[model samples]
Target: MKQDIHAIEVHNLTVSYDGKPVLWDIDFNLDSGQIIGIIGPNGSGKTTSLKAIMGLLKPASGFVKIFGKSLDEVRDRVAYVPQRESVDWDFPASVLDVVLMGRSKSQNLFRRANKTDIGIALQSIEKVGLTEFKNRQISQLSGGQQQRVFIARALAQQADLYLMDEPFVGVDAATESAILELLREMKSNGKTVLIIHHDLQTVSDYFDYLVLLNTRLIAKGTPPEVLTRENLSNAYGGQLTLLSKIVDLIRQNEFPVREKGFDL
Candidate 1:
């Protein structure tokens, strides 16, 4: 079998803040029409990896290739939905208004958003099942709705590849399902979507490929291959031991003052 000509490629992708590293040497190839997941604990560099690929934050010593070209060289062919927390939700913009920004890259800088752009924005909003709220202020929507809006914006970009960061952070089941369904549709249409995912329990069902990361790339392969116990342990830095303790406590309601009551 041959490796697909990757839609996105990263090699020796190390990014740091000051002298401290955020992303260590990471290498992966993302092929078109796949729903790939990036999963790791907080501070495990999942989001940082996505940002490096999007060219939002420059890698301290590595390169990112989009469609086999530099990020800038193939920017319009790639779309990014940054982590929702990265933006101010209070900004003055309606849902449709924000989605229109996706088309800006294709328009003359001095030109105003046109009727055709409005149609495309509306189409994207509809795809995300947010058509009725197109005129609603973005800040007015729930967390999930805001997330869907971002996905809609990416859809409006009509890019061949999409890089999304932690999209399911606070989304409701319906909205999460809706967003995922749309992504599947995009894949069926030959678009590649790389999402930063947090829920390990759902990883098997959610993505076709997995990029398990810590400060470095722990593993990369189909979920069943890369998400093994050893790789997951490496990604969690053995914190799974402590994390499991907390989860068991939560499930048992074993508060500091309470007896240990276990769940079946």
Candidate 2:
């Protein structure tokens, strides 16, 4: 069969920082309309891979193609939500002001946001359940509300492929649920989403596909296959040996932590 043209394809991607290698020769293809999660221990190049894909960092030796086109050629078709902590929360901007930044690339530098842009931004904010808080300063909202604003920004971009970096890190349960629901809706609408996530326990529940990384691609498949004990060991290392064992047991029994009374 012919390869799918509408896929995110990374080929021989190697990235380094100050002569020190971070990501090494990674390759994978992800098609549209699936919620894919990238998981690994800290310093496993999860964020690095995302930065490279988003063109925030230059790869030493590789390329990423979205919808079978170079990033520059399809820049507008891609939306990225960087790590929440990466920005200054104190910036003086309202929630809607921040979300409208998503449309910046489409407008000339001197052009002001048009009515259409504002309309789209409002719609995105509503989608994330933040319509009432759109006029509020971003820093005034709770951590989860801030995260939702970022998600709304990405939605406003209206991209075909969404790349997020650890979106669930500091958010509350309600915000996490809201984000996941929006992601599922995006997938149902035929948009592909790749999230950099750290939680191993919730991996199986949140993603339809998985990418396990450790300075290199470890495994990419359905959660059942990629979250295996051996794969977790390879990705997270022997330090998580006991944790991996517990996860494996949980997988085998298909029981929730409360059901098993195991402290996670």
Candidate 3:
């Protein structure tokens, strides 16, 4: 498929926490209407990259652009759905109340939530299969429900670019499949999704493009091209020796044992 027009551009992006570089000299282009994944081991700066791109954390140097303009200049065109654990789930709030927060950003900071906003919030909640539990307190919902609720809020914004931080963490297999399908639908509808995915086994099936990051860009390309031995070695800190050995061993086996009832 042809790449969509560029929607997000990062130039020499760098971020530091407590004066220690967490992300360094990162650069990439994200097109409109593509589902991309950011993957690496824990603490690989995946979330940090998303935060920096969304302007939640300022880059120590360099800058990010949205639609050829500075992030600050086009804030409305971008949206962020942070990890569920990032918020106080136990905080007093209903499903409807939480979804409404997405629209609140555009209203006067102190204005009371309005009827139109409430309608939009309810619509978003329904979109994520949470309508039946709209009145339930947020804490009462399961992990998957919470993730869907947040994704619904992002949909409400109708943003051109979305940065989701681990939207699948703690979700069940069914919910994971649901979320992936939703992302595919978003791409078809001309929206961009950049997700921080943890499951390497599912990476190729989930994303078209990937940024295999490890405190830096290990590789950035289509899934097959980027997930090769060389890129895996770099991203995994030169630990591909074991993976290579496994592949070689598997290839050399004369009659690979296909488990009973699982013939390949």
Candidate 4:
């Protein structure tokens, strides 16, 4: 397989919420067929970056290109698993029902799933070791199981590029191991996977490529190259206090006073 070209690219991307900047001039090109992790402190736009790439959130400026094309041009080739906490598991949907939703991308609007779609959904559930719970309601499963169901759904889509946000946030050790194994399998099958991860200890073990972000593009490269102490300190240090102060001001419809120009 050709590995010379980029699978995803972001150029000067910036995003904001209610006049509060979240991502700042982000730029990166990710190669295909690897487990890539994006990590940073909370409120560092980790989720926001993935959302921008998947077109779930619009960029205030700049652009995102999937396989050298706009999201609209390559939507079918991409699959996304958002942060589990962002989803309402209590919604009335069964395990199989949620997994089958992945097939919606392969069909036209208002269309029903055919037999083949059902087969694919079943296969995905089995791959994630959730076949026994396929018929169970989503809310009835544990946090790990719920995350696996979402992964199975993304798998059923059969997309070449997968973007996942914090799939390991609330899972048990066994579940985390299982998900990482599945990600490795996907990489072996020539798929590109990008995940938003938080744990600093497992960074080197789980991902071959790492993108460090703290509301901006801090560094991007192999874990060995980007996971240095200096980078980590810069990305995470003073973030909590800064975030709290900014949020407090935003709630009051105001921003911190600064000199002519200052970087947040």
Candidate 5:
């Protein structure tokens, strides 16, 4: 069987801060048109991997390719939604203003938004269910609404691949569901989305593919294949409490048990 070109590929990616390694020899390939989740314990270099892929951070070594090409070759075909905390909510920009910025790269940054750009921004806002708040200042919106605004911005980019960092971190259940629905719609439309997610419980439900990492690539595959007890133990170390929860999830969902000789 022939293989499709991966939406994103990272090979031997090593990143470090001040000589202390954050990610070490990470490698993975993500297929197009799937919702993929990157999950790991805190400080496991999930966000660092995303930055490297986006070219925000220079890898200490190795390379990343998008659509089988260098990032610069397909930069316009990619979009990114950063962590909410990384943004300045008080920048005095309306939701529409922010979303319209998504088009800045395609358009001359100094030029005004054209009718087509505004139309696309409006549609993106509607897709995120934030049409009513489009004119509101981002600072005035709640956490979930703010997150939706960023998603709308990313949608406005109209990219083939999206990299999101912890989009569901502080949202309510309803907002989470709404975002997930929108993500599924994106996937159905053939857009590949990779999200840095921390919630292990929702991993199986939210992602068609999962990449479990801890300073290195632990495993990458369909959720059933990557969320094994041994893999979880390897990624999370001695976090027995988390392991207990994983065991319960495995029992309840009947996921394949791939390893033996250790109590789950």
Candidate 6:
């Protein structure tokens, strides 16, 4: 893809279920080589927007472009990691087996994985710190391990852009930190990762760009620009207790603050 092209361009996107809108006329553009987060309260359509971008769900209106082209035009350059809970753990696949699936798109459907493919899969597993578990059944792995397996699968794809939904939802702190480190490494290598995330306290620390949504586009910018009192209230309906915590974080110098010419 061209360096000047945005990683993703979502224009006037809307999605609905049973005629009730889940996402309403949302719009945003993400630059390449950064970690971006989509954050919102429960039932706020965070995952819905992600699915729309990935073409997993049909939008009621509007469109999405990946790297200055339609999703079908650049699908090979994108990788998607769905929520762990949405997957079937008992599918009887080993870690290596699942990771190799990432390479399937590049090979003949009826062909078996070649030595090169296996090598790539093993390298991806090692990157996730799961080399020993490569042969273990996914169903036997812990929640964190299972999550890592999916990440390894995405890594094996070697895509330029990664779209993940709630990757940190059920993992331990160590796993979360490891995943963050890996994501940072990917960013340094010029990969753009857009994640659907919760955990407001870590939003500023985890992502370079932030998209705050609630059935519509609330805010989209750097963490300091989006996590302000007014934007949070607009997206989250002024939940005082949550807002107070964010305020306290700012006062304590925990959350990010704009350097100049802007106020929270």
Model 6 ranges off by over 4 Å: 1-3, 238-264
List the candidate 1 regions with Cα displacement exceeding 4 Å: 1-4, 237-264
Give per-residue CA lDDT, model 4, range 1-264, as digits (tens).
Answer: 566668998888878787666887789999999999999989889999999998889877778888888888888889999889888999999999999999996346788989999999999999999999999999999999999999999999999999999999889999999999999999999999999999999999999999999877778999999988888877987644665567557547755323234322
Q: Which 10-residue window in model 1 sums to the lowest lDDT?
A: 255-264
Instruction: List TM-scores for all candidates, in order.
Output: 0.87, 0.88, 0.86, 0.90, 0.88, 0.88
- In candidate 1, the residue pairs with backbone N, CA or C atoms under 3 Å apart (3 or more residues apart, or in different chains) clash, namely none
Worst 10 residues of 2 by lDDT: 255-264
| Candidate 4's TM-score | 0.90
Residue 99, model 2, lDDT: 99
Report lDDT per candidate: 0.83, 0.85, 0.81, 0.89, 0.88, 0.89
Candidate 3 residues 90-143, lDDT tens each?
Answer: 989988877877875653689887898788888878778888999899899898
Q: Per-residue alpha-carbon lDDT of model 1 for 69-120, expressed as tens digits?
A: 8877788888999989889999999999999998888436888888998899
Better of 3 and 6 by lDDT: 6
Clashes of each: 0, 0, 0, 0, 0, 0
Work out how many backbone clashes candidate 3 has: 0
Q: Model 4: number of clashes?
A: 0
The alpha-carbon root-mean-square deviation between model 2 and the true structure, to one decimal in Å, is 11.0
Better model by lDDT: candidate 3 vs candidate 5: 5
For candidate 1, the per-residue lDDT at 140 reads 98
- The alpha-carbon deviation from the true structure for residue 43 of candidate 5, after best TM-score superposition, in angstroms, is 0.2
Per-residue alpha-carbon lDDT of model 6 for 1-264, expressed as tens digits? 366889999998867666566776788999999999999989889999999999999986789999999998888899999999998999999999999998877437788989998999999999999999899999999999999999999999999999999999899999999999999999999999999999999999999999998776889999999999999988887544554454455546543333333321
Worst 10 residues of 4 by lDDT: 255-264
